[model samples]
Target: MKTDDLITVLARDSSPPWRFRPVLLAAICGSIIAAAALFFAGIGFRPDIAEALGSGRFLFKFVVTITLAVTASLAVGALGSPAGGVRRRGLLLAIAPALLAGAALLELAAIPQSQWGRSLVGHNARFCLTLIPLLAVGPLACFLAALRFGAPANPGLAGAVAGLAASGIAATFYAANCDDDSPLFVMTWYPIATMLVVLAGYVIGRKLLRW
Candidate 1:
């Protein structure tokens, strides 16, 4: 076929590669399963954790609401852009985690009460360290899947999807393990974590999805 003819055909038939579907499906399913497990496991809330952090109210509901909003916003933004171009995306992703970790560290360190500061530092560090790996896995999986199957026309969409998947997984695990059933815990920790994961997704999508 002539080059121009081939180009026309490719353009006319353009669609996201088929491999992405299964990866996306797995991510979605995994997130749902994680959330369900957290809910049914009799781990409803953690007042003690909230009290320690100094905010105690409707923890589960607050986290869920905030999570939904953050995830929706990130996903929408990501979907609006194209995927690939690794260098820039990767840098952005790398910076996100660093920024999140730094912010948490600074907050924990600046607390005036030594006892409380120590407690907060321990809690935040433990939570971040443990959750970061698990949270990263979901996005990494999605990135690999996107690459294997071929990225979407919009890389941003992939980032958003991956971000949501990452956040859901992280939140489920956080709920199950942390035991801090307070609005304060969710309000503070969840947003910070989500921001990190979304940034990671954006960077990963850019680098790994490069066509």
Candidate 2:
């Protein structure tokens, strides 16, 4: 075939460029929803949730987790595109920590200084460490699978964002069962748990996401 004819045929057959946003949203959202369902089925909301709802501490717990989820989800989605990465500069991912730190400060000011350690060392440290990562499994897998559809220039960063998103979703679910309402508790243990997942994602993505 002539070069012109080949070019014309290829142009005629070419489809629109692939868009990953919708699928990315679906995968992340669906994983969270599924994990939430399991969480509710296995461990219902805090029995005192109605009373707890009135307190800023209780509500702030959700705020921290959900905000992390939102920002990390956005970052992960951004990283899915070849040029969408913000991790190289580390800007997008900074939002979660900054917000948490602000909350932590507010918590410190509101509570007794002597009791600071008590709030930070809430009763559920073991549970927080275990359950957050446990809940992260599905979302991490789903987010990683979603990344397969796009070209992420930094697989490790993309994967770490996915891990952050997963941990946020997981922590949100765990918050319902967690009796510790203090932002200090969340600020302390949650990051530790999420970092474990992020490390795992980095290692896994480095190996799995090679194009």
Candidate 3:
């Protein structure tokens, strides 16, 4: 075979490469597992879980808030990707999540001294600090995976996946460590801190995974 033909064959055979799939799969699975574990650990299928679920109002709000924030971050990051050089694209992706997370953290902190306010601050701070390691782990995995496999065709999707996974892992830790089981606790503080870390992941993914 001619050299050009051989090169073409090689490229076709190893398109996007295979080495990185395991890491990406692992990151995706790990995040999902972490979220499920936290859900079970937090309330199980017990009366508390049922009661919390029964309060349809709070449950609806919680789901909507978490879903929207995650979706929005991913969308924003994905939409901003340019088709050429890496520098501008990388910076834009990094900035979006960092700004979102920082803003969410600030919003959480800015609440006044009511009972809800105090609980939000206390729980969120504890959750944030504890999940720092796990939060860092998802991005590390993503960065390594991206380096080996090249950037995903859809960065927003990657960002969303990474964000959810990071949040889920952190939430699991929060469930295991935190004594508070109130829906109010989950609704108020959990989403806020989760979004912050997700934002961090988005920023990191953009910078390190310059495809």
Candidate 4:
């Protein structure tokens, strides 16, 4: 059966109205807190976090991740609505990438080309890949499950946005623990890890949020 038809049938059989916004908000807040708790309990911040905070590279990581999280969260809201805004919301996803690319360019200009490879292959590439998704688990689950109450025009797309949002939240936490703060490393591995979550969200959303 068509997803719309399925939803219509479900809606007809259901009596109570479902408010998507509050639930989504609750899920976002709760999931972020949960992720933070898990991060602190298990991994915690890096030993040199105080020193790292003074570094531009370390602070820039937060700028990128936070911007990504905010933008992606907004896009998820746009996508979750039944109203038309798929294109605009999709464009919003680009800001994080654009910022990272600009940072990478600056890094390239500031640092010698010979050191580029070393920075890109920083010490924690594997951990970055592993932990971001590990950290994303809560946000992704909360987002997808919360979005079930929403009438997103395209569930798959909504799910993907949720993935981006999740990754952003996760990356923000992981960055605290990660000692490697090079823009090259962030640009190289962060997106790969994000794609892992996004791909997972797309596949899962196709199945779980189809309507």
| Candidate 3 residue pairs in backbone clash | none
| lDDT minimum window of 10 residues, candidate 3 | 76-85
lDDT of 1 by residue, 157-189 (tens): 466446654665556555544654433344466
Enumerate residue pairs that collide in model 2: none
Which candidate, 1 or 4, has the higher TM-score?
Answer: 4
RMSD of 3: 9.0
Highest lDDT against the true fold, candidate: 4
TM-score of 2: 0.86
| Tens-place lDDT digits, model 3, residues 119-211 | 544544564455534543544354335333534444544554455445544454344445454444555566666566667656666665555
- lDDT for 161 in candidate 2 is 82
lDDT tens readout by residue for model 4, 67-129:
999888888777666552558766777888999999999999999889999999999999999
User: Rank order by lDDT, top first?
Assistant: 4, 2, 1, 3
Q: What does candidate 4 score on TM?
A: 0.90
Better of 1 and 3 by lDDT: 1
The lDDT, on a scale of 0 to 1, for candidate 4 is 0.87
- Clash statistics: count for each candidate: 9, 0, 0, 0
Model 2 lDDT tens row, 55-116? 88777878878888888888888888655667553675676778789988998998899999
For each of the candidates, the C-alpha root-mean-square deviation to the true structure, in angstroms, is: 8.0, 5.7, 9.0, 3.2
Query: TM-score for all predictions?
Result: 0.50, 0.86, 0.44, 0.90
Q: lDDT for model 3, on a 0 to 1 scale?
A: 0.47
Error of 1 at 79 (Å): 3.6
